[model samples]
Target: MSSSLRNRLAAVVMAVAAGLLGCTPASEPGASSEPAKPHRVLNTTAQPEDTIRVRGDHTERLQAFLRLRYGDKAALDAPWKDAWEDTEVEALRPVTRRVCARDTATADGQEQTLLAVCQTLDDAATVEPGRVDLYVLRVGTDEEKTNRGGFFAQLPADDPLLVMAQRLQGQYGRHGSPGTVQIAQLGPQRRAFQISHEEHRRGHRRVWRSYIAEHNHRLRDVARYRDHLDNLALHGCDGNPADCGEGVFAVDFNTTVGDSNAVEGYWPLTVRASGHDCTGPATAFYHLIFDARQRAYPVPDDLQRDGCADS
Candidate 1:
């Protein structure tokens, strides 16, 4: 089936699994007295030089960089101001005038993304072969405009990353386009960068939990629960409408290799699909194998969750 269909299925299935595997309920009754006090600041920023390098001048540095910093802002803002201090010189290969998907329009299921690769500043080049193939940047409308000064570059509709983002956004009922884009090398390792669902969820859950804990009890005690509910309901995903669906989805980064850049890695991608009613949860599963090369590792047999047989 199509990748979008596969992703939706995977998300639904995983969401269910995520709910079952480790979700601590809303902490009703004396269940822990208080839901961990909301933890105030549950920091999710990755440190600079958090490199996960593979073959073909590929490193996770850029993706990690964007995730920890610019994941919430536009390309120009690049919130992780301090990371540059420790980053190696090669990883600083910044590009100019790349378009970024807008923030406000993204909430209605639209997706803003950045797809880039590392190359030498001295020589023009494309993303190194076998480097990460896809990356996404998700943000909110009201969030500050981070692009301090740079021309935005739009992506051709055929571009893989852009196509996928557009499709997914349509599924959720929104529209957007790329903002600014660029790539850098922090030393010898080349890196590709983009925003991801895991990063967004990290931010969303932290904020949601804090808001609920702080006001839920107060509202109930004062018989102002409806007031609180109305106020909260007005604010949607990063300010989108309530029906815009949850601001959570998945992103996959694949790789392609050239003959000259042979490295040890498998290129195996497994996708499963299932459906559910609109009111019920949707579910699917995805398991991929990769070689040391960080490329897709092929598998001999189609693997599925063991023990579930056809009726």
Candidate 2:
């Protein structure tokens, strides 16, 4: 399928999940606070590095881990902060709290192999901004379960992901059940529930699109990646090969965390990862992050470009 179509489909799936689970009405358009200048904030003093493993390939294991944490909704939208070499803090909001796992393990029939060093974030902590404790794991399915036995503890009450999910669920409940959230059906291939999810996902994308369109800006030209480990690999760990360079970074355009009156709300970024050299197109797990952060930071000069076209 085309990239746009795939994104649209992903959105539909997320909306259905939201309606079923009754998530909040997603974040308000101008709810995000102003962009915070790039400052090194400790993730969380309490958070420590840890790891977990799942029984599957890298893709399945990662997807399952994401589903467990973010629910099916996150697959529709990917969230993160954008910054430049000279960014100044105008506003800051915790977009997601991720714990990087190293040397994790996962089962693959007769043998256990290290698939990926997993990073698991409490779905509840993603909403706040700051350094969060992270762990690296040798890939394995039982590692997370085993590690959490005594080490797991409570997180802050206002963690961004926790708060956002709570609020979203409340909204979804208030709106009625997932079955009640409906959208115009497109055809035999598309269902009402699917359409609704797509709409919610698009709600955020529309915000980003509008922001860029209004400002005559485009993602490849205006944004920069935070250079986290996952981001580095996802964006192609310096190789920047043509086939491995497609990526989309979505940000919220508002100022407050949950403010109900922001303008031109969502920000969906589409970056062609191929700029680094000959990397191919990169991909995001979500179609639209039904509820995610919106960052306002500048892009690095060396990374700016027009489209995801071949360099």
Candidate 3:
């Protein structure tokens, strides 16, 4: 082979060897030989946790708790303030603040208190027309601990009950409404949290969704259903409000915790709804019997369907 051809062949062989060994060609003077680091895409999703910081002061500890619970998605600045404090934080106001306690015996037979703190996020601008976020913290007394407390369970913004309610809202083509969170005593040592979303648009429409959840090590959804719906627009009141007449269709639910059977733990929920639609007046009764296999009260198809006829 010719000298020039042999030299080109040798260069090609060296390049192939370098490519096989994952070696890059030398760069110009002062240029970096190190490959550029990949840009890291951070996971901003909030992770619900059952443990939090319990050492700092009330405010500091709350701040730490929010940070730990929300991670990168936590807005620690303006418009988002802690509603747990006694006084209002600037424009933000406390919508719901519930504290429930239960007595239980520890491993050593010492009586311990289980405290549940439930609060809802408040927005100053849209105070009464938006779906508010809820935060729940289950704290236990620990005399030996420095802070004298330890969190046992927590239900953050990503709670299943809240997600289900939001999904219902989406299905109804409704947005921006107010909701409430309350603690319910189901039995002796059993406590459950109930979340209710209510929306009323004067003569146009009205809707309500409710959910009950209990925490046993982790949060479990017990009952969820659309409690009420009153839509006047579906019949003939869409164009003219005054011509609505008596052509309104509405559904109202009356729920009872336990039945006449007097069952013990996790009492059954019975829901009864009565209303009149375009067709005629109707009444529906549903016994939210707990199924041990599914661990959730399955809502009936008729109950889940919209109670209004097509316009």
Candidate 4:
């Protein structure tokens, strides 16, 4: 072999050796080559993650769970901010503590889900791995189903926790929150959702109770704007005679990461409101910032403001 070729081969072998050695931390003091992984890591091989491709809403809710802080962890402190609509979320685990599956009946038919009780653990974990519970939700598809209506919930008798997660996911994801109560009258919350029954299902009533315990989160923001700019005066017909009503706030559904097939997917929520008094225009946009260890979806109070100057 030529000396030049031998030198090139030696360089390639050295590069491979360096990469292999860098897989773990160095014995000497220097930054480790390992990258920072986010909290809510999913799909462990020791205890495999669920394979169920749940209804769109459930998937979205799961994503909402993934983004929030798990506690006062310095590492996981991330909040939603301005004009980040195209922000891409890593497909991190939804902090699932426990997952249970069950069946429920409706006028239209029956539906099933793996009621995963989720929590935020550091990339390492907050609790002992043995202490954490486990269940696998292996989902089935249309082609595999021999019968119609897909999969139906067939959990162990009286496993109320699974039942409850099924109920809440169905109710909230189905009807949404209280201010905008969903009428039970709406059939199947719109359209068809099917599940497979071939898999043996189990329920842990404890999981449902835990899910409910952390589910009640509220977001509130107090913004009082007074613009005496001739037209933008507070409740004043003097500055701008033709005054519109109070600024309108509406919830905007984030389509990204939501189930592409379903219209409304999950609750990584955003609030949009536009206000003006003729001098110009102002808007407040809010998205629930997930803190560590949140269970239920919280309407966000943190509002990012956008305004057009009168000057």
| Maximum-lDDT candidate | 3
Q: What does candidate 1 score on TM? A: 0.17
After aligning candidate 1 to the native by TM-score, how far in Å is the CA of 180 from where it should be?
9.8
Task: Report each candidate's C-alpha RMSD, comma-separated, in the order given.
Answer: 28.0, 24.1, 16.4, 20.4
| Tens digits of per-residue lDDT for model 4, 224-290 | 1211112223333333233444432221122111222322212233444444422335355544332
Cα lDDT tens digits, model 1, 95-146, are 2222232221132254433343211112213221111112333331211212
Taking the tens digit of each residue's C-alpha lDDT, what string does model 3 give over 181-243?
A: 556655444555565665545443544554444443445666777766666645544433233
Q: Rank all candidate structures by their TM-score, best first, as comma-separated numbers.
A: 3, 4, 2, 1
Residue-wise C-alpha lDDT for candidate 2, range 1-311, written one tens digit per residue: 23543565589888898899989466788786876454422222122112322345555654554454333533313433322121234334333322222122222231221111111222213222122111112232333333545222232111111100000110111111111122211122111111011112221111111111111111111122321112233443434343344453322222212223223343333332222322333332221211223334234333322232112
User: Of 3 and 4, which scores higher on TM-score?
Assistant: 3
Candidate 1, residue 151: how far the Cα is off, in Å: 32
Off by over 4 Å in 2: 1-55, 75-77, 80-129, 141-311
TM-scores vs. true structure, each candidate: 0.17, 0.18, 0.48, 0.20
Model 4 residue 210 lDDT? 15
Scored by CA lDDT, what does every candidate get?
0.24, 0.27, 0.45, 0.27
The 10 consecutive residues of candidate 3 with the worst lDDT sum are: 159-168
